[model samples]
Target chain A: MKTLVSYDIVEDKVRRKVFEACKDYGLTNVQYSLFFGDMTHNRREELFQRLRRIIGRQEGKVLICPVCDKDLRLSKAIEVSAGMPEEAAEAAVSYPGRSRKKARAG
Target chain B: MKTLVSYDIVEDKVRRKVFEACKDYGLTNVQYSLFFGDMTHNRREELFQRLRRIIGRQEGKVLICPVCDKDLRLSKAIEVSAGMPEEAAEAAVSYPGRSRKKARAG
Candidate 1:
């Protein structure tokens, strides 16, 4: 499944930790406080737990939204200037599984 | 369906318009540039179009992620000190339909 993770943290140290954690999970940074990635159900759960530990009981917030591949394909992302990275834009538009197969075939 | 809308805009005027558009759709502001709301599939589509119009060809980004109620219930939201508004927190944890019924019964 594709997931969109967004966060807002006040503490600088904690915020950096959170960013590193997201990257550690192989997630793509779409924006400053936003990330997107493809992960299995189990992996998603694990990522959530890791984030919770990093966040602890601090003054911050994280929202993990599970986006359906169908909805994602139907969704439109318009970039005026140099918006998201190529990889992030690809993740948003294409189904990861299918795209991986295409990559292999090519 | 529950939707998590997140945005990052460089222009002040466009950002304010996007914020107001989300509120007009009866969405709750979870953070400065993030919002959460419940809407039907059709309404969600309409909201998307409106956001696109507001964004136009500018240096802004908007991501609307649809969240399943079941997944939302399983999701955990922890607030340290005044994290999210009470309403936003409730939306994250409970099934909207069941919660509405409970409210009526009570």
Candidate 2:
């Protein structure tokens, strides 16, 4: 399932560690401090545990939520400045699952 | 339906406007740049259009996605530093819908 991870960490060092951990867990950083990716239930739980350990009752906060595929399909991304290249946007709107390559190319 | 909204804008003024707009739409700030709330399909679309206008091909980015209630049930929040009050957390874990009062009180 796809999961959404959003975090707010006051401490810079800990925040960086969490960011790296999320990346290692195969999530894509869609925005600063926001990540999303697909992973299995077991892996999601493992990631959650690892995150908990790293955060460890400090002064930061993390929220992890699963997002269904239907929701993802209905998701909207708008780039105000320099909207994505025409072809790239079309690819994304048409075949989101296959748009990664087009995105990379664009 | 519950919706997740995430934004990243280089311009401070525009970003602040977007933030205020989100609050006006009844979305709660979950993080500095992330907001989530429940709204109907029409309202979500209206908000999207308004956001698009505010952003207007500028150099900012926004993402909006619907989140199912079931997903919210499985969602997890961890606070590293000062965890929520025991009662508040328990309330959220037990009856999330009714935890708003407890959270506000705490």
Candidate 3:
């Protein structure tokens, strides 16, 4: 299964620490802090447990969610994977509508 | 009602265009390209439609995902919100374990 883990870290120090942790989990960098990766369902729970411990040590907090249908390999991953093209395609359409409103608001 | 929208845009031109759309939608900046904001369930479907139209014009593709709880305010939001702290706390612990393993693997 492919997991897109999005984490929220308050401190820059914490972000760096969390980034390292994500890299350890074999997740590829999609943005500055977000990650996309492949992990079996069984492995995901275990991975989440380990990530939790790291945050506990740093005195910081984070929210890690298992996002759906992200390309873990970044550019390459997007091309080869057909696990859920429909969902990704749907997002393509849904994303801009909100964006247009947001631009007008600001 | 809070929505976390994550978009994957292949082209930089497309990302910029999409970013504006997201800003227009009243979503706050949480990262370089990710957004966290509040929207009623009723508003969500409408928002998606608008975004799709925008993407169609761009000749690019994107993936917008409504992620789970992320404090849109960035800092103080985390404090005031008690809607889901346990999940965040759990992530704190889980993030690290995976990090440790990744460090070893690398």
Name the top TM-score candidate.
Answer: 2
Per-residue alpha-carbon lDDT of model 2 for B1-106, expressed as tens digits?
8898888887888899899999999999977788989988788778877877776656777878888877776676665446665443333322122354553453
Report the backbone clash tally of model 3.
Answer: 30
Q: Which digits, one per residue and each the tens of the lDDT, describe model 1 over residues B29-105?
A: 98668888887778777887787677666677777666666656544443444565555433333223245455334
Stretches > 4 Å off in candidate 3: A57-61, A67-106, B1-4, B7-63, B66-106
lDDT of 3 by residue, B15-89 (tens): 676688778888886655567676665565555556565555343433445433331111111111224466544
**Candidate 2 clashing pairs, residues 3+ apart or interchain:** A57-B80, A58-B80, A58-B81, A59-B81, A80-B57, A80-B58, A81-B58
Residue A8 in candidate 3 has what lDDT?
59
DockQ of each: 0.30, 0.53, 0.09
lDDT for A100 in candidate 3 is 41
The sequence of per-residue lDDT tens digits that candidate 2 reaches over residues A1-106 is: 8898888888888899999999999999977788888988788778877877776655677778887877776677765446665544333322122355553453
Q: Which ten residues in a row are the worst by lDDT in model 3 chain A?
A: A71-80
Least lDDT summed over 10 consecutive residues: which range in candidate 3 chain B? B71-80
**What is the per-residue lDDT of model 3 for residues A1-106, given as tens digits with 9 covering 90 to 100?**
4565666556677578678877887888765556766776556666665655555534443444454332111111111123436554443322222344443342
- Give the TM-score of each candidate: 0.71, 0.78, 0.43
What range of 10 consecutive residues in model 2 chain B has the weakest lDDT sum? B89-98
Q: Per-model C-alpha lDDT, please?
A: 0.68, 0.73, 0.50
